[model samples]
Target: MSLPLNEQTVLVTGAGRGLGAAIAAAFAREGASVAVNYRNSGKAAENLASCLGGKASAFGADVRDGEAVAQMVANVKVRLGAPTTIVHNALADFSFNGDARSKLDALTWDEIAAHMETGVKGALNLIQAAAPSMRERGFGRIVLIGTNLFQNPVVPYHDYTAAKAALLSLTRTAAAELGPFGITVNMVSGGLLRTTDASSATPEAVFDLIAGSTPLRRVTTPEEMADAVLFFASPWSRAVTGQNLIVDGGLVFN
Candidate 1:
């Protein structure tokens, strides 16, 4: 039951740059028509689309808004095709500077809610909007981007980690519900990626420390993680669902 990548349409959210961009590129390489969805990085997204050529295009939509997401999907259907594969990789405005993170005592509910709005709520919006089309087609692939911190929590990124934990729950539950409709829901969790917009603030020493701790002895790149994402959407993983594949240079084993 391997999907013919050349015949599929993929929608990658927050794909203007970073891991999202890499993921979009991976799918395009497989001959899938890709919709690079971005909230604010319009220029970057368009540039990436051009780089990918005809099979890829940039779309603007805030996943947090259900109506906007619906519109985005509609647009994709018109410009590309109704997306049979969706990658939820959008992140709220955040930086990986541990020193700037809110401590437990100072962490406010609003801060936590901000992450939820994008992670959990946004996922819900995407599923609701895309599921109908997938159900009609009797095929769909939904991949949620997650974090290794949910398992290790070494840095105690309370708010960000908590939202991801919730997303994991959604991944399993959604998988169970959508299975009958031929939709697979899964997650790809990664540790601190070597260099992404969110992790740009991390010092080089931190990267070296993390790399040393991992069995691979190197930081995983966004491109590496993006490759893992492609597996879930490919025919090779047709029977796999409701699972989380962690891609962090073997730092944490699940």
Candidate 2:
């Protein structure tokens, strides 16, 4: 019972590049109109929208700001119809350089707060803004981008991992509240992606180490993870909700 995405309008946050961009493209390929949301990468977002053509368009907003998120959703509705699918993939500015990360002793509450602002608070803002319309229509899909590091904790990225764990909790809680409205909230977690702006800072040795450790003997790609995200938004997953689907090629089985 797979659902076709033909008439869906999807809004992907932080879609200027990285996994977010890939997710937006995947939805477009499935014939869904896409709103590519970016906080700072305006040029890249616009270029991607142009490349996508059709109903795809670029939008700008800092997801941390509730007002900004509200305005962005409103604009998307006027331009591409209300988004029936929302992907909360926006990340706080971060580099996946384990060597440079602040260890537990040096980690500050401020650093943790930064990640929470984007990962947890940002998802909250988007869901609050979009849930009303979704409830009215009796249909919606909310997918939060997560990290496998929460389970593996290979490098102890304290701030980032903690934030994602909180987001996972929010996903389930949201599912319980929104299920009656025909909305499903779930998470797509991926391990060290081969290369994204965030992961580009990671050393080659790290990538090789993770690849060798995975059953697939390779690092996952943003495009590959995007495909798993599609399953949550499609008709195939209408009965599923609050599940965390890891897309890291067996890196950490949950």
Candidate 1 accuracy as TM-score: 0.99
Candidate 1 Cα outliers beyond 4 Å, as residue runs? none
Clash count per candidate: 1, 0
Per-residue error (Å), model 1, residue 69: 0.2
TM-score of 2: 0.98
After superposition on all C-alphas, the RMSD of every candidate to the true structure, in Å, is 0.7, 1.1
Worst 10 residues of 1 by lDDT: 1-10
* TM-score of each predicted structure versus truth: 0.99, 0.98
Clashing pairs in 1: 2-235
lDDT of 1 by residue, 169-202 (tens): 9999999999999999999999999799999998
For 1-254, candidate 2 gives per-residue lDDT tens digits of: 23368789999999999999999999999999999999999999999999998799999999999999999999999999998999999999999999999998889999999999999999999999999999888899999999998899998999999999999999999999999889999999999998899999999999999999999999999999999999999998989999999999899999
Model 2 regions more than 4 Å off: 1-3
